[model samples]
Target chain A: MTFARILQVFKKEMIELRRDKWARFRLVIPPIIQILVFGYAATFEVFGVSTAVLDLDHTQESRDLVSRFVYSDRFQIVKIARNQQEIVDGIDDSDAAIAIVIHPGFAQLLRKGQTAPVQVIVDGTNSNTALIALGYMNEIAATFSRDYMTDHLQRTRDGPPLRGALVTLEQRPWYNSGLNSRWFFVPGVIGTLVLTMIVNLTSFAIVREREVGTLEQIMVTPIQPVEFILGKTFPFFLIGLGEVVLIAGVGTLWFGIPFVGNPLVLLLGTSLFLLSTLAIGLLISTLCMTQQQAFATNFFVVNPLFTLSGFSFPITSMPTVLQWLSYLNPLRYYLVIIRATFLKGVGLSVLWPDMLALAAIGSTLLAVSILRFRKSLD
Target chain B: MSAPDKPKIRVAGLTKRFVGTTAVEGATFDIARGEIFGLVGPDGAGKTTVMRMLAGVMRPDAGSIEIDDVDVVADPEQAKLHLSYMPQRFGLYEDLTVDENIRFYADLFEVPRKLRDERTGPLLAASNMEAFRRRLAGQLSGGMKQKLGLICSLIHTPQVLLLDEPTTGVDPVSRRDFWRILYSLRESGVTILISTAYLDEAERCTRLALFHEGRLRYCDTPKRLKALMPGTLLAITSTAARDLHKALLGRDGVMSVMLVGDGVHAVVDDADRRVPELSAALDAGKIPHGELVRVTPSIEDLFVGLLKDEHAS
Candidate 1:
């Protein structure tokens, strides 16, 4: 409650942090590395899939179909096989992820307006990549068939050519026009990195003091438990904010991820998020007796917060039990605010519910941490 | 000014238990104003536990601690305003310099800038640590660290100062310097309650309390405690000191035999009557004895004898 005492503790902790070269280095370097590493490494978009083709027909129609597959950037033809055994060998050697086999009468069937049996083989070891690649192949085949039907029908029927029976659907994605996965992951990385770093930094604050015998000395002073907790956590809150800005900058400048939201809204949301994380850190510190115990507890707490926050996986896809658990995780609300602000350029009106959730969870955690900290002092 | 007859600190039946073991049991003592009181015991004798309860950092399961007329258990913050405690390991921020550490404590106690400047200069000069103010606390030698710890604890000029084993691992020269600081504080009317493992250090205090197995064995001035020794102590030296020690163990009038540096110091019921009997016993046992003389009983001798009696009972 005493502002002067709180400020005194805050200033002392800040000075120690500034003087410790190792701590300073840790504050800056790891977040930047994490921004670069996770932004690029964690993506679901499949590109440059090595493909092999086995062609039994030497006709122009088969050649043109093979050329269509080669032109799409998603598939790269690594081998052209003459027989079935070679196709199997190429796949077994890991030289190709997809294989296409065309029957001998493929041109004749297409010319005669009959269905052509073409087989597309895919490696299922990486299921996500395989599924996306299959979608791309299906789209390419559908387009080729439409083009053939239009050309053949236009030449045969001259007057006001009748349209085909099939209905073509055109797709346009919003927010992310190109559907680049980087835009999704980079902002999420900011949320995860800030949460983890701030939690770890503050989690060990009190336990380290206890281990080194300073907590006993400080307890003998006239400072209250609330003042002590405030003084210990406020400076780290600012440091966590600095890390947010740093990682966001890296995400925007280095990775070309857009920052489309109001800076003020981002700041507000970030403040609430920092409060929750810092409170959780103080709570962990109160429960533990040593820095090692604090570190271990942090690992158990942060991993679930990160995973269930929908950082890499969608919360909707998680089981019902885990989905409900994610609602209690403050990082989930923060990630929603961050992604909405960064990608959709939304303001408080769009993110008010998430922001409210964050405030509710944050204040509750802060109150609990304060109570636990007071008990620990006794 | 406070009344002279009133005690500065009062305690009654302080007890603390940890899980399955009792750390301090039914301990009661009073410390007068402006006196350097010492709690003397070996490791695990509840010295630290007693100091912690008095400092208000820890609460006893069953006890009443009144410091400067304030109940520390009910209102520790108010009690803490007039007290400072330096734990067994005085917590100093290792990354901070000595000056910064002192400033931090000054701030926590809300000492004004003017008063801090006035007080810090004299304390540093007295401790001879003015030159090392800018050195990091982690970089200072062990002796200097202890001095700095004392300086930090004394910055706010509290009425009562509690130090728990402040000189356990410190070198002898630094230990002497530390006592000098305590003496000056005593001259300024500060009540100091210090715990120490060294019997020599206990002798420097105005009064001492001896603890064993979480219980108080004796509490009085050092002179009075030494006078409580049961019998006359005689120091016996001989080339066959070990054989003579064995020969004199069960002889008549011999109460106890303690080995002290290549000789045996024994307590006898009557020195006049027992010395001849002891010599005759040593002669019968074919032990050659050199010199035997009476010596004053030290605090160690008194405690050892007291411990033996407690065991026998």
Candidate 2:
């Protein structure tokens, strides 16, 4: 409760932090690197995809079709093969990720106003990349055929022999229309980085006290358990707040993502989320004897939380049990609140449940941590 | 606040049980003002548990711990105001500068702004850490770190100081430095209850408590504890020391033969009556042995003899 004592604790921790230069480096640099690397890598918009082409038709129409693929910037032809065997060999050997085959009758069929089939082969080793490449290939092929038919009808001065058989599918993406993965992942990175540091730092604060033999000295002092907990948890709370702001600023300014909701709400939600994560960290520390054990426990929690938090994958797509389990994950709700506020501009009236969930998690974890810490001290 | 006449620390029927194992069993002892009391025992003894209880860190299952008339069990916070505890590992922030650590503890103890510098300056000088005040604690050597731990404990200048095995892993020279600090603290009228595994170091204490298997086997001054040994100790050195030990164990009057470095010290009943027969047995075994000389019983010898007697009774 005393401000002076808390300041004293903070000062001591700062000194310890200053002494560990390597650890300080870890805290600052990794977040920046993660923000930058993940910002560039996480994108749903595919471009410059590597591909190979087998022009067995060896005709002007086939060459023109391949030129369209080249001009779209969707596919970069890495190999120009002479036959079907070469295309199969290239894709089979993993030298090219995708392969295009123009059949021998492709030019004749197009001239006769008949349907011409262009076969696209893709590697499914990494299904996500493979699926995105397939999506681009389908779009390219459909557009090329539609334009070719329109030009053919204009040149012949007659209507096409067959009426339109291909049905047009209208795509309306919800939430993020452009599917800018950076807009989604950059904000999520803020949560991931802040939670990682806050939880890890706060948990180690008390546990390290026990390891270094300082906890006994602190316990023997007039400082109460709550005071000790507050003292240990407060610094990390501030650090977490700083991290959130830093990542948010970078996301908005550098990555061109919008921050549409109230900053106060964002701050409050993140603070509550930080409290819960830190509490979980401290609880783990109490159950562990060594720093290695605490670190390993943190890892065990972090992997599951990140996977189930709906950051990279849609929680709705998960199994029913996993979807329900995501409700128990603090990151799930926080990510929702953050993305909604930053992207959707949703207000507290709409996001109150997430806020309440965070508050509940924070208080429960804090209470349990204090009880366990006090029990261990006694 | 307690009256001046009351003992600084008083523990009666104090016991500590961990799960199914008893760590301390009905330990009753009192340390008067300004005394350096040593709690000596081999590893796994309950010395640390008793110290922790008195320091108000661990609650005893039974009995009361009063520090300067403040009931430690009832109000641990009040008891803390009168005592300082340095655990075995001497918890220190390796990253913090020496001066920062001192300031931190001093601030935690609520030391007055005006007098803080006066109290800390002397401690810094006494521990010879003034030059390295700006250096991190982790950068200091083992002895220096121990010295810094003592300094932090003494920052508030509590009435009693409880150090749990402060010298367990310290080198011999650092152990001496640590003891020197303890003596200085003693001169300053600080009541110190230190636990240690080194028997020779126990000789430095004003009073001693020999603990084993969670029980206080004996509690008295060092001299009195040594005198409690039931039998005379005779040291026999020979070229065939092992054979002499084996042969002497068969002698009727010999109670025990403990190998002491190069020789074996035998605990026997009536040294005069047993000396000739012991020499004859050594001669029969073809082991060349020297004269049996009676020496003063060391704490080690006394403790072993006491355990033997306790087992027999």
Candidate 3:
């Protein structure tokens, strides 16, 4: 309520911010790098996957099967291993992300008009990418089986089906036709960068004061608790908001991504999300005493939050429990809002529930931070 | 409480507890207007805890603090207007320049723009920081930083100033300069309460309160505290000062013998009477000796004796 005191606090924060070039850099660079790292490097479109094959049959049929996988552009045959031990060694050494085994009986079974099973193994450590790689492998194998069956049936006096020889499914992707990994990633990158920068920066503010023995200095003044918390939080709040704008602009103009949501609604969502993160950061500051502790704790919490934020994988396809867990994650909400606004063109009416949830989380976090901060000081 | 118009600050039965440990137990003290009172003790003696409670940064487990007759517990905000506290580290914003820090504090205390120019000039001059006004506080030396901290604490010009070891690591010259500023503030009728571990700094205070194990051992003027020494203190220097120190441990008329630096200082009862026996013992040991003049007991010596006496009882 004391505008003068709040203004004083605001001035103090800005002065401190302007002095440390690194902290300011951290505030900006973290988000920018996160946008690029998460946007470009992170993807569901698995390519150049190191795959090996054990082809026991040296017939044309077996060679044709191998050619099908090579032609799919998904897997690169890294090696043709001699036996299962070599395949196991390849997987263990991470030299290959997938392995396919074709038995010697494969060609003979095809000539005898019998189906033969081909075994495929994929590393499931990074389960999301592994799953995508598995899907690509299945598509290749299915096409090879269809081609062999059609050739064999013609020789057995069966003609092509009445519904034309074959029908190729035509895919038309809306908004992002190329499904550019950059387009899908940039918005989430913005969300994550803001999340880490705002949370880490604000989280250390109060703890740094405590470590340097300055909290007592500020507390002895006539400033109220709410005023102090808000004063310290606003600059970071604005920075987080600014980061979203900067990243969105960069993502759109430089990266060729589209922005279709109502600007006002988008800003409102971002503001709530940033407010939530700032509160969480402030709450962490109250719990930690030293700068190192604050840093460690922030990183520990942020790692999983970013991983499970639906930026890396689709939440809808995850197991029901994990999907439900995403409901409690603010990153999930923010990611949804960002992707919707930037890619889907959805507005307030469709996204009101997410906005409300963000607001609730932000308010709760702020209240909890203020309470803990007061208790710690007392 | 003393008389109705006794002092500008009064604390009665102030206690502070941390988890299972009691930091300050029933700490009672008073500081008159325009006086420099110090809480003298080593670390963990609850000096900082007491100051924090008085500053309203912390709440007491039990007791009352009154600043210029305002109840600190009932209304801490109003009470804060009458006091300014600089914590141990002085809380300098390293990134901000010297002048910016001062202005920031001034703004927090709501000093008007017109009055800000009038007050900041002398403060900066007193701190000898006028030339470095544009320099970041992080670039200042240890002493200048302390001076700037003092200036920042004084920006509001509160009636009472609470300092928690403002000169702990500062050099002697800067410590002296800091005390000079405090003296001027005292002359201007501000009540100053400071906590310090340095005995020499405690000697300059108008009054000193000795604290140990969360209890006050003694509180009086420096003169009166030295007068509280029940017997004479003699400085003893010899070739075998350590051996002689051990020999005088349980001897009659020997109050205490403590090693201070290279020499041992012995507190004896009637130094004139004990000198002959001390000499005879030295003769048996065949150790050359230096002067054994009777000297005033220092604040360190006084507190050590008090703690020993309390242990004996």
lDDT of 3 by residue, B205-286 (tens): 9899988889877899988888888888888787777887787788888888888776788888888899887778767767
lDDT of 1 at A372: 88
Q: Which candidate wins on lDDT?
A: 1
Query: Worst lDDT window (10 residues) for model 3 chain B?
Result: B1-10
Candidate 1 lDDT over residue span B258-283, tens digit each: 88886888999999888887777777
* Predicted complex 1: CAPRI docking category: medium
Off-target runs (Cα >4 Å) in candidate 3 are A51-55, A78-101, A119-130, A158-181, A316-325, B1-4, B285-288
Off by over 4 Å in 2: A18-24, A55-68, A80-85, A101-119, A144-178, B1-8, B122-135, B169-189
Q: Model 3 compared with the native: what TM-score?
A: 0.93
Instruction: Work out the iRMS of candidate 1.
Output: 1.0
Per-model root-mean-square deviation over C-alphas:
3.6, 3.6, 2.9
Segments of candidate 1 deviating more than 4 angstroms: A53-66, A80-93, A99-122, A144-163, B1-4, B232-297
What's the TM-score of every candidate structure? 0.89, 0.89, 0.93
What TM-score is obtained by chain A of candidate 1? 0.91
Q: Measured by C-alpha RMSD in angstroms, how accurate is candidate 3?
A: 2.9
